[model samples]
Target: MSPRNSLLLVLGMASALLAQGPDLPIDPANSFKVNLPGDGPLALVSADWGRSSATARGGAMLVDLHSTLVFKNSSPRPIRGVSLLVLAQEVTPGGKASVTVPSLDIQSGESFPIRVDLRLMRPLNAGSGALVQVGLDGVLFEDLTFYGPNRLNARREMLAWELSARRDRKAMLSTLLQAGPEGLRRQLLSVLARPADNLVMGMQVARALPPTNIDPGRVVEFAFLQFPDSPVELLSGEARMTGTEARAPRIEIQSKSKRPIRFVELGWLARDEQGREFMAGTLPADLSLPPGAHSTIRRENTLRFAKPVNGLTAYPSAVEYADGELWVPAYSSLKDPRLAAALPASGEERRLAQLYRRKGLEAVVQELRALR
Candidate 1:
């Protein structure tokens, strides 16, 4: 048999041996031990899938997940079939529970990928919120490691995505700078950074604006240049507890901007005992823009804290808040100057360049939190 198949057989035998008595529900509190090839312990990481409405593709709304598991061997022996218990909550409070997996397998000193497809078994009748949980199960012979949407994993993921996005942005900017005029370059940058939802609106505005005495090229350039350095900057803002509501208390944030901004993001800065600043929550809302000349855009966001107080994992980072607060980032200007400069000029360089200019590490956490 092939090495992979051989490993699978070994794992199946191991799982059967580990399966004793009635299969108890996986415990969320316990840690799964990973045995490596050599000595020491294995590390496991898990990320929850971000919940997205899959109604368009599937008849019912479904939750899709992609998790990466990494196993490092400390000894010479190989390992496989590392069973893991995942915690999932219903979208509605007190929802039903079920588990489904398309496929699962692993190799020693190697990584494996797992996907979970979840669908709502029944309609949520009544509930304030949803509940999900994940835990560890099974055994690892040597040192095993896993990474996913959890706090640490999310941070690492976001940082990687951010680097990619920045690289892409730089490469695109470079190309536009070489081929287009100053105005066009600016416009390209703007469109690249504009929120996905706002792109159409911004385009509509560009079309409506009378070129008048302006050159058509320049007008096009102006429209393109209107994109921002980044979506939803905190020009000057602060968060405050405004009032109490019947459902949840309200927290308000007010901010002013120099340009005709598309949206405003209100982020809460909180730190643990270690003084590490983690994002609390983000509120994204549309800002009213006045006609003619520059204007200050003012906006507010309201958040109601949950009773019994959810833990830190409940909060989202700023990048996630921006996405949740408004629209997805526009993939435009994959051809702009700032983006181009940061990326390779050609070939596989283009593909590699596109990978790094996405978003930051915290954004992944926020997306996962939203799923929760």
Candidate 2:
């Protein structure tokens, strides 16, 4: 698959939430915000059951519900992620099941499709046809801020968890500051042991500092390759590498399109003079540049590296705009292995993947199966 397509696949696999429904499709009109504010509206555009099947598994009947869910952004700004509280609208007897949809980036007025695959065991005394009910519990923005009616109280629950996580983070930072290097590894492992529900903590750990903090004076320049049909131009920018952290203080872009540009993401690749290369990270640009206007993105987000290197030059691997448009490496560009390898993984991704790796898939399955 092409890199952009691969990115879409990775995003789907990485950011899904759990939920469920019935054999028949339900009208999305019934799905409403329970406690959300009137601002930043997100709509369930549609929901349909694509297929269903039943089979005998060890003496119980196993059922599978495959579905397609469509969501639209009705708000003014762009959205990077969504969280829903999906419940089994109706179930006969008592069957256990869960549903999931990808966390995604959605531009204003744009709609996207997410595949829902649910599995449950048939209840011994249950009748045919189960109904699934879903609600908009919360919405996550690109800046990590959250909003929604929160009918399921997920926001409140998450807030409680985050508060606890903050305490834990403060303690860990204290350990790093006082205990010094010898006692650090044990704390790192302990932090990694936390559950995925501690989302904020997981993100912090991914960007955790190395035992020895060193700020090298090495500087790297960013080269621009504009989108094939893009009206935006990358004028100038550079990033400084200190230890494993890369910081870009200023990135300038010029817009020539009639429509104002609202967002842009530049994929970073670290290539040393020796040709050794790997995926570095991404620079996300949220802007409001009108036609013929130029915007300078300040150094705010920090990109992390697996190891320190020298003589690096960064390039754009992917780019997205406000008008529900995207720019990624063309299929032919994949011929250059370096461009193909720079798809950066976020810290949260590294933490959670490590969680699954150490705790096993069954642990993850159990966590998602719970209705909390």
Identify the leading candidate in terms of lDDT: 2
lDDT of candidate 1?
A: 0.31
Residue-pair clashes per candidate: 58, 8
Best by TM-score: 2
Among residues 3 or more apart in sequence or in different chains, the pairs in candidate 2 whose N, CA or C atoms overlap within 3 Å are 18-99, 19-99, 21-132, 35-149, 36-148, 36-149, 89-133, 279-342
> What's model 2's lDDT at 98?
32
Q: What is the lDDT of residue 315 in candidate 1?
A: 13
> Can you write out model 1's per-residue Cα lDDT over 1-372, one digit (the tens) per residue?
999999999999877655422222222223112222233323444433433221222122222333333433333444322333443333543223322221122344544444444443223222222323333233333123322223212222223233344444444555444644444334334444543331110100011222233332110000011224343322222222221101111222222233343334332323234433333344333444322223232222223332111211211112222222222223443334433232223221333222333553233223323422
Candidate 2 structure quality by residue, lDDT tens digits, 1-372 = 999999998877655421122233333334211222345567667777656454544344545657677878888776655655544434433353333223355788999876667665654244433334445666655444667665543443343333333333344345545765334445454435534331211101133333334554456666655545456777887766565555644677787677766666565555544556555545566678788898887765456555554534444443445653444444344334545344332333334345456876444334333412
TM-score per model over all chains: 0.23, 0.37
Off by over 4 Å in 1: 1-116, 121-259, 266-268, 291-372
Worst 10 residues of 1 by lDDT: 198-207
